[model samples]
Target: MILAAGLGTRLLPLTKKIPKPLLPIIDKTLLQIAIETACKANPNIIVINASYLSGKITEFLGAHDFGVEIKVSVEPDILGTAGGIKAVEKWLSKDDFGVINSDIIATVDWDALKKIHKNSNATATLMLRDNPDPAIYGPLCLNEKGRVIRIVNTKNRDLSGAEPLLMFTGVSMLSPAIFERIPAGRAVEISSEIYSPMVKAGEPLYGYVTQAEWTDAGTMENYHKAVMARFATCKTSIGMTAKSLKYVTIRPPVHIDTGVYIRAGSTIGPNVAIHEGSVIGASVILKNCVVTPRSNVRSGAFLDGEVI
Candidate 1:
């Protein structure tokens, strides 16, 4: 299940116009990237839960096919991570299911998590990453055996063997048993409300440590970072012919989509994504920012750390 119901309060104006999941990251929306990533796991079907602007979610899903059966679970009132999954219990309870947050970009090893959960008899297996300050992000402490013994300040089991705390990547593989812990028709967070109590009860919860690239695109700054991360392997990606871009100094890692017109003498890049139909005036300097579709950047304007 892909959790796309959050209000995206942190994203502000960007999200005010479009749902967080629908926010574009270069060529694809965040939701599309997440769904494609989930498809790598070879699941029989994909389920997405939407609330805020649920119509757009449904419309977007209908426009594409990710080679898997995709279904949208619309929530009249926002049901959080736990409740979202619980509401779709009937479809997911057939077997263990995977859940991913639409606001995050991650490369989780789903097969590894499935194996870990199956072999360890764990009720749920979470994808965790090594962070210097897990406490700041709410830690998920794991033992030497890779069992999650604590979440944030709550610990249900003894933690004498706890390893360095890790960060939750918001990607998990859960068994049907988790449904019993989540109440229906309500907002229930997975960490404090569900997992923490399960930990205290000795229910096996495991962690799959991964060294994959991940970024939470819930905030504008982080969203910019996520877009920049996608260009790490390639220098610059131009959606159209080079003849259309003349006298423009494009630094590496810059992405200029089709239909975007950049005037002469403009410098763009070192982490920039100018979407389709945007116009960049002459002598404009854009760095570390995103230019939304159909926008007009006035001449002589300089943009940094912004989304316009």
Candidate 2:
């Protein structure tokens, strides 16, 4: 299940206009990336849980033709992480499935995770990564055998024999058994509600450690940083039969949506994307930003943050 139900309160004014998952990082929305990543796993069906601006999500997914069956679970009221799982209990009952946070962008090895889960006979297998600073995301302690012993605050330096801390990577393989552990009709966090209890009960919870890049774009700063990072690696290309003004300076790695009017002396890109119908003013400068459709950037303006 792709968890996209959270109200991204941290992303404030931007999220107030558009859902966090729908916000562009580079050129594509976070939801699109998550869906594409999950598609690589060859799952029979992909279930997405959406709450904030559910119509936009539904419409966006509907427009795309993903190979697998796509299903959406709309929550009338917001449900915490664990509650969202419970909300999709019926769909998950069909098989042991994968759960991922929609906002996290990572290159996960889904096949390897599935293999490890089956081999370990674990109720749940969590993807873990070594983190230098555990204070921000607490720490996951593991025994010598690599079994998760507990999650503890990094401030408690008094705790002895604690191995190097690892942070949860927001991706996991879970059996249907997890649903049995959570009570119905209550909002709960997956970490605090389910994982913590399972650890205390000595239930088997395996961890898959990898040094992959992961970014949680839940805040404006992180969002901006992530977009720039992604743009840096994107291949530069100019679409076939596209027109460009002689005086316009477009650096590499930019995507100009069709019908965009980039006027003379305007500089776009190095890391930028302008959606359709956006009129780039003369002498305007846009760097490391995204201008959504139908927006107007007046002349002599500098746009860095996402413009909608």
Candidate 3:
């Protein structure tokens, strides 16, 4: 299951037009990448929860067929992370299911994590990371044996080096039993209401850390970082139908979608994604930016680290 219903308030204006799930990562939307990644686990179906601007998500799913089956849990009132999953209890009760946050770009090994979950006999197993500075990222305090004992405060802690902490990677394995604890059709937070108390009650909540490339694209800085990393690896990909004038500098890692018109003398690249039907005027320089679909970029403008 993918939790994609969040309003993405931090990503304002950009998400003002498109939902977070549909945010582009490299050449694919975040929803597509997440679905493609989770499909590697060989699950029978993928369930996504959508709320903000759900029509676009519904339209995308209706038109495109991912290799695996997809079911959307639409929230008329914006059910939160826990509530959204709780509503899908019937679909997930058959077996333990893995949940992924749509805003994050990760390459987690689901098969390996499943084995660890089975071996540890945990009710909920979260994908963790041994980040150097767990202070900035919320910390998941774990015992030597890998059992998560508690969730630290929700702020950037300036703790000393002696206390080791692992950050929650927003991916977790949850058994059907978790549903019984959370009510359906109500907004509820996962960490505060579910995992924290479960850990205190000795319910075998474990943390499994791995060295996967994870980019939490919830904020602009991190989103920019994710774009730069992916562009460095896969480079730029321009749609064949995207029209661009001659002498325009097309830098690597920039993704220009179909129907985009780029005027002459404009430079774009190194972490930029211009969505379909957008018009980029002459002499414009865009770097580390995302131009939403059908948006018009002013002429001779320079936009850096922004979502136009």
Provide the overall lDDT of each model, using Cα atoms, as 2-decimal numbers: 0.86, 0.82, 0.83
Better of 1 and 3 by TM-score: 3
Q: What would the per-residue lDDT of candidate 1 be over residues 1-308, giving only the tens digit for each residue? A: 89999998998877776888998888789999899889989999899999998999999989997889998899999888898899999889989989999989988888898999999988899999986664456777888798888776643333344457688888999999999989887889888888989889878999999989888888888888888777776457898677766688888788888898999989998789998888999999999888877789999998887888
**Predicted candidate 2 versus true structure: per-residue lDDT over 212-240, tens digit per residue:** 88887877777777777887677764442
| Residue runs of model 1 more than 4 Å from their true location after superposition | 154-163, 239-244, 247-249, 263-265
Kindly list the per-residue Cα lDDT of model 3 for residues 205-247, writing each as its tens digit. 9988897888888886777677666776775678744344566
Model 2: pairs clashing at backbone N, Cα or C within 3 Å: none
Ranking by lDDT: 1, 3, 2
lDDT leader? 1
What is the Cα-based TM-score of model 3? 0.91
Residue ranges of candidate 3 with Cα displaced over 4 Å:
132-135, 155-162, 240-244
Whole-model lDDT, model 3: 0.83
Q: Report the candidate with higher TM-score, 2 versus 3.
A: 3
Worst 10 residues of 3 by lDDT: 155-164
